[model samples]
Target: MDSRVVNKGQLPELLDKLARDHTLIAPVREEENVTLFKKVSGASEVQLDYITSDVSPKGCIFPQTEKTISYTYTGDTLEMKEQDEPPKTVLFGVRPCDINSILALDPVFEGKFLDTYYLEKRKNTVIIGLSCSTILSTCFCTAFNSGPCDGKGADLMFTELGDKYYVEVNTEKGSSLVEAYSQYFSKGDTDKLAKAKEEQAKKLEGQFRRKVDLEGVKQVLDENFELPYWDKVFKKCLGCGICTYVCPTCHCFDIFDYVTGEFTGDRFRCWDSCMFPDFTLMAGGHNPRPSRKERVRNRFMHKLKYHLDRYNLDGCVGCGRCISKCPVNIDITQIIKDLKEVGQNA
Candidate 1:
């Protein structure tokens, strides 16, 4: 619960120091209007001004294409190898919405089936969440009990205040990091800074254009799985899978073998989307979700109902990446609003 202030001028030095000791993953300006979280050697590579990255930083923990196991066979002799150890990592400048999205993902990978690939990276990484300075029109983190400055899943949270960053150490990992780099961070009046951070959070909370209400929405989905709303909602969907790809919480994946030679190959798992037509396609050409309607329905159901039922966590973190990216504007906020209306009418 200790707080510190890092002068804006010294932030680069701090990041460079951390980079030398750990794998620094932060947002970088790849091109015009494109920002991504990549491994940076120093603070010079980090883009501190972006509203949000084009894609979620979930790739830092769970990669898009990960080889789980490699196998080699020669004359009935088989050799298998697992993935290498994950590096000590520092994920910096992630917004609260994306931070909560990681919380949504934690259960899925750490459930009955212990995913070592994701867990290892998760264990080794320290998240330094940055409070959002600009709230986009598509943002709706408040609907899911999170906000621009919420620090639920972060190890440390940084709130930019003019020439300095108000740093809140929230975990042991964060405390250790701060202690290691004590020179960069100076002691501030914790009481005043905390009050200022709260005021700032409240101010940013008011800027959200999207007013999302989840009241009775999940219950509606639970009661009426065959609602007529699905018929209308799916009509506009192109089944492009863009929403799932941009979503930080979406964990659906497919596993297959990649052959290197006649008797050697690696078994890989790549991110898959429920929006795709073949997501539920079976071996005998029988697809459970044959059309866009079912696929679309399943996607929302998982977000609003099924995931919570199974994991006791909200599947969607209301990051609004899906809202911004969806070509036809298949908004989750709109869907929730519609579902609530349907529930009332029923």
Candidate 2:
């Protein structure tokens, strides 16, 4: 757990070095109100002051659309080709909640059935997490025992401590990268800077305006699978799927083939959402989740109970992108609070 200090002025040079060595992905402001994680060449392309990107950087690992294999068949001959290996990558400026989301996803891709597509990118990438300095109205990471500065799953964590960046090397991958670029880091006793980061985390915790409690909410969802609560929430849902798209933990996808010619095609996988009606449709055209009520119930149930039941980890990380992006103002925190109230009444 060695820590080092780097002047804010040297960040550009550090980014330049990393970009030259690996594929660099960081947050960049596309417009006044929009910030998205994109491939960057240096610090000039990175938005270092953003609270959160509009979209999670999860796409870097499990892409929205990916070609799994290409195939061609002519007469009696057939040929198939798999995709290339992912390049060495540096995922920079990830928030702690997003880091937690990646951990939540790890089991889904790594258990009895391993997803090599995701595993390859994960194996070749180095995660450089950034500590959150400010709190948004929707943020409630504290409810999950995660804070703005928690670096639980990161290889390296960078906290902006006034004029300098306090870098904590948490893994061998991080240590090797730091050792390789020793010129950017300054030798120092990082105790004072680490303390400052803690103080910053505490201050930001109190600044959170939302109080999200999950004490008995999961139990309620587990007991009452068919509730009048589904009727209330689903009425307002537009089935837009924005929540799943912005969510860091939602990982449903569909696979099919795209025909290129008479004897050629490529098999691809793309993101799918349980919020959509077709998500549960069978090949016979019978949909288990036939209405918005069932779909909406399933979505929240998956978040509150199912994922935790399967993975022993909280499915929702309280990042609040779903809350902020929902056109009808459907909030997961509000849902948890309401569910707790429902449980108390029952």
Candidate 3:
């Protein structure tokens, strides 16, 4: 429960030190408007001023494309090889919404069927969550009982307090790191700093422009899976899979083999989306979700109802990446609002 303070100027030094010890992944401005989480060697590469990265930091745990296994054929004999071990990693500057998304993902990969590829990386990485200073019009983390300074899944959390950062160690891993770098962190006035952090969180909470109401959304979907709502919502969808790709919680994927020659090949697992027509298509030419209506309905149902049914967790974290990236303006906030209206009428 002990908290420490780090002067704003000392952050870069801390990041540099962590990078030297572990694989440090943080937000980097790749281009003018594009920011993504990438492995950095030092603090000079980190972009701490960004609102949010264009892509979620989930890639650090679950890579977009990974070779699960490799094989080689020699005459009549065959050999197989597993992928190498994941590195010890430090994921820095993850926002609360994305951190919540990582919580939602834990059960999925750690449940009945264990995904070692994801589990290995998750086990090795330590997360350092950063509190949001600015709330965008699309953000709705409050709907999920989270806000800018929420630190539910992080090992450590950092909240900006003017010229310094109020650092709270949330887990043993975080405590270990703090102990290792004792020189950089100093004990601060806990009561006063906690009050200031709370005030800052409240101020950011009021800045969210999106008001999302989830009451009866799952119940409505449970009762009315074949509603006319699907027909209307699917019409505008381009099936580009932008929403799923940008979503922090969307975890659908596909696995296949690629041959480099007749004798050598690799098996890969890549991210897939339900919005794609082939996602639910079977080998016998049977497509369960044959049209945009069915696919669109399935996507929302997965976010609002199905995932919760399976994992007992909210599938969507309300990060608003899907809202900002959708070319057709098919807003999830609008869908939730409309679903509430439907529930009331019924």
Model 2 quality (TM-score): 0.98
TM-score of 1: 0.98
Q: Please, what is the whole-model Cα lDDT of each candidate in the order they appear? A: 0.92, 0.93, 0.93
Ten contiguous residues minimizing lDDT sum, candidate 2: 30-39
Candidate 2 C-alpha lDDT tens digits along 1-346? 8888988889999998899899999999996668888889888999988997899999999999999999999789889998899999999999999999999999999989999999999999999999998899889888887999998899999999888999999999999889999998876759999899889988888899998889999999989999998899999999999999999999999999999999999999999999999899999999999999999899899889999999999899999999999999999998999999999999
Worst 10 residues of 1 by lDDT: 185-194
Per-residue CA lDDT of model 3 for 1-346, tens digit only, reads 7688988899999999999999999999996679999999999999998897799999889999999999999988899999889998999999999999999999999999999999999989999999999998989999998998998899999999988889899899999999999988888676788899999999888888998989999999999978988889999999999899999998988999999898999999989999999999999999999999999999999999998999999999989999999999999899999999999998
CA deviation > 4 Å runs, candidate 1: none
lDDT of 1 by residue, 303-345 (tens): 9999899988899998899999999999999999899898899
Candidate 3's TM-score reads 0.98
* Model 2 bad stretches (over 4 Å): none
| Clash-forming residue pairs, model 3 | none
